[model samples]
Target: MKKLILISGTMGAGKSTVSSELKNILPCNVFLDGDWCWDMQPFTVTEETKEMVHDNIAHILNNFIKCSEYENIIFCWVMHEQSIIDEVLSRLDTSGTSVKVFSLIVNEKALTDRLFEDVKKGIRTEDIIKRSIERIPLYQNLDTIKIDASNISAKEAAQLIKDKLK
Candidate 1:
């Protein structure tokens, strides 16, 4: 049977890292990172842009769900709100697929440290780090399994999800 794994988390909580590791560990898996769909030049996070990105993600995921080429479709994104999760779930066709949702969580200290390292690596800026940290609370009370990523490596977190799939 096929499976759809939706992984959500804060910016520095290792969603992308875990997704990559999960893809490596799982067979016939298709990995989709929502950020890839929104490679906008300006990169503004307006309401309209959010809707467009979500629509694009949903459409692509819908196609993945319909395809039989992959046994597992892994999607990672910052689904900070329940409504976004609902919207994505509503867009998918799960006739013969098992769906699993997981959220990676980290404490503020760990998050700040990670984002700080990212900033030092020149991949991210201070403004982005502050903004991401500010939005950490948005993941609260989300309707998904929460995995503590504060001290775990990406491979370890991927193994946890892998164990769950079995």
Candidate 2:
């Protein structure tokens, strides 16, 4: 059976970085970052755009799942809510897939430091720090494996996730 790995975390929690490393270590794998679906100018967050992004992600993931060339489908995004995860899963044909969900948990200080570094480098604006920090506790309530990423490197985090699969 193929594996469908869903990686979730607050912004700046290294979801993209870890997922990238995971794709490298996994055989016949494809990585999909949710942000890529929402890469629109003006970055709108209206209900319509949210729906469109979800549909687009589901479409891409479903196509990947149907492809026999890939044995592992790795997806990462800021999936802070159960409904979002459900919505995406509901749209996919995962009949023969073993699905695993993971949330990258980070300490407040560590998250703040990471976001601040991104801000300093102009990768992200300073306003994103508080918003990202506020979503930290939300992951605790999620029904998924939690990886403590406060002190670990992205490669280490990916290794931990890969170990969990075995």
Candidate 3:
């Protein structure tokens, strides 16, 4: 059976970086970032757009899951709530696929430091720091495997996740 690895965390939690690294380590694997579904100009956040993006993600992921060329499908997103996870999963045809959910947890200090660097580099805005930091505690309530990423590099985090798959 194939594996569907769902990685979630707050912004700046290294979900993209770790997912990329995991892709490099895994053979016949494909990685999808949920943000790609919402990469639009004006970046609207209305209910319709949210529903559309979720549908887009599910559509792409289902294709990947059904493809014979890929054995592992890795998806990462800022799934801050269980409802979001459930919504995405509910749309997927996961038969014959082992689904694993992971949340990358980080301490406030670490999260702040990371986001601040992104701000410094202009990768993210200043307002994002506070909003992202505020969501740190939210991951604690999620019913998924939590990986404390305060001090680990993306490679290490990916390794830890890969080890857990065994």
Candidate 4:
């Protein structure tokens, strides 16, 4: 009876800020930060924590289904592989739950600029940024809407998503 709007994009792609603006216009929604799934301790993305990230997402999805107070959920995170994205979506699609995904993407230049901004904010590093550059969408279905975050303002992008969802 409710919708799950899953938001995915590279870091600094404005997913969080744009989602926030869209949130004011939405009803019965819950916003989740995918990065929060990462170990809160300061650590680089490496072999040690790879599975943990996926596991964390699965756990979060479970929590969302169990919450009795909310009618809709918007889960936001950095999504890289389409297979992985689809797998997550398939899992969440079970048990009468509806899942929709929106992907925010940009070019290498934007990635560099955003990653550098993260370096300043202390959420990323040169290595992490290097690995993510040129990463493509993980899912290719018609249900997914991919937006160019580099060429638009947050307000404009949010409107784009709202329009697309209509």
Candidate 5:
């Protein structure tokens, strides 16, 4: 069975950085970037988009995994809220696929700085810091392990994940 590793965190908390590093560290593991599932959807900040956002998370992720090349998959996204988290877990559980979750977190200031850089680089489609911060406090509670990412390089972060997986 293909093991599904979901590395989730708040925005700018190094999810992509660590995901890439971890992908390199793991032998024969292929990464599926959670962001690619965006499907060119318009970025939105309205509360009205909540259902759409959650549906995107579950639908896009599940669909990608269904046809992806890798049997063992590692994916990263800024996933908050237990309901959304449960969607993945429930599917993994029901399907008998092994699953692991990790949360990467950092100081609020570091997060803000990263978000700013992402915005400046035109990578963070939604550049609203307030919305980003509003969701940070909950990431730690949704995962099996929470890694303090403020002081760690992506390489070190990846090593830690590899160690834990072993």
Candidate 6:
């Protein structure tokens, strides 16, 4: 059986960074970022877009699960709610796949610092800080594993996930 690893967090919680590092550490692994499915220029957050994005993510994930070239699959997204997670998971064919989900949490200061750096790099706008922070609490109390990502590099976080999977 293959492994399916899903990493979820807020906008500045290093989900993409750690997901990339995990790909580097794992041999024969396929990595996918959920943002790639929702890369609309105007970026509207309607229910229709949400459903479409989830469908797209599920389709890609099912493909990855069926592919034999990859022993492990990694995906990163800002999944703040359990219902969203459930919906995505329900769409996957996991008959021979072991799925693991991790949620990254950071201190408020660390999150703000990361968001500021993202803004400086032109990857994120300043208003994203407020929006990201507002969803932090919603990420907790879920069924997924939670990791404190306050003072770790992406490589370190990936190593932690690799260790946990072992």
lDDT of 4 by residue, 97-155 (tens): 66668888777787688779888888876786766674543323325678888878778
Off by over 4 Å in 4: 42-53, 66-68, 136-143
| Candidate 5 lDDT | 0.73
Clashing pairs in 2: none
* Pairwise TM-score winner, candidates 3 and 5: 3
Which residue runs of candidate 3 sit more than 4 Å off their true CA positions? none
The best candidate by lDDT is 2
At residue 161, candidate 2 shows an lDDT of: 97
Reference-based lDDT, each prediction: 0.90, 0.96, 0.95, 0.72, 0.73, 0.92
TM agreement with the true structure for every prediction: 0.94, 0.98, 0.99, 0.76, 0.77, 0.97
Q: Return the lDDT, model 2, position 144.
A: 96
lDDT of 3 by residue, 1-166 (tens): 7999999999999999999999999889999999999899999999999989999999999999999999999999999999999999999999999999999999999999999999999999999989998999999999899999899999999999989887
Q: Which stretches of candidate 6 lie over 4 Å from their true place?
A: none
Cα lDDT tens digits for candidate 1, 1-166? 9999999998888999999999999999899999898888988999999889888998998889888799999999888888988988887788899989999988899999999999999998888777788877777789888888889999999999988887
| Global Cα RMSD, each model | 1.3, 0.6, 0.6, 3.2, 3.4, 0.9
How does residue 64 of candidate 2 score in lDDT? 96
Considering lDDT, which of the candidate structures 2 and 3 is the better prediction for this target? 2
List pairs with backbone clashes in candidate 1.
Answer: none
Which lDDT tens digits does candidate 6 get at residues 7-44?
99999999999999999999899999999998999999
**In candidate 5, how many Å is residue 44 off?**
6.1
Enumerate clash totals for all models, in the order shown: 0, 0, 0, 3, 0, 0
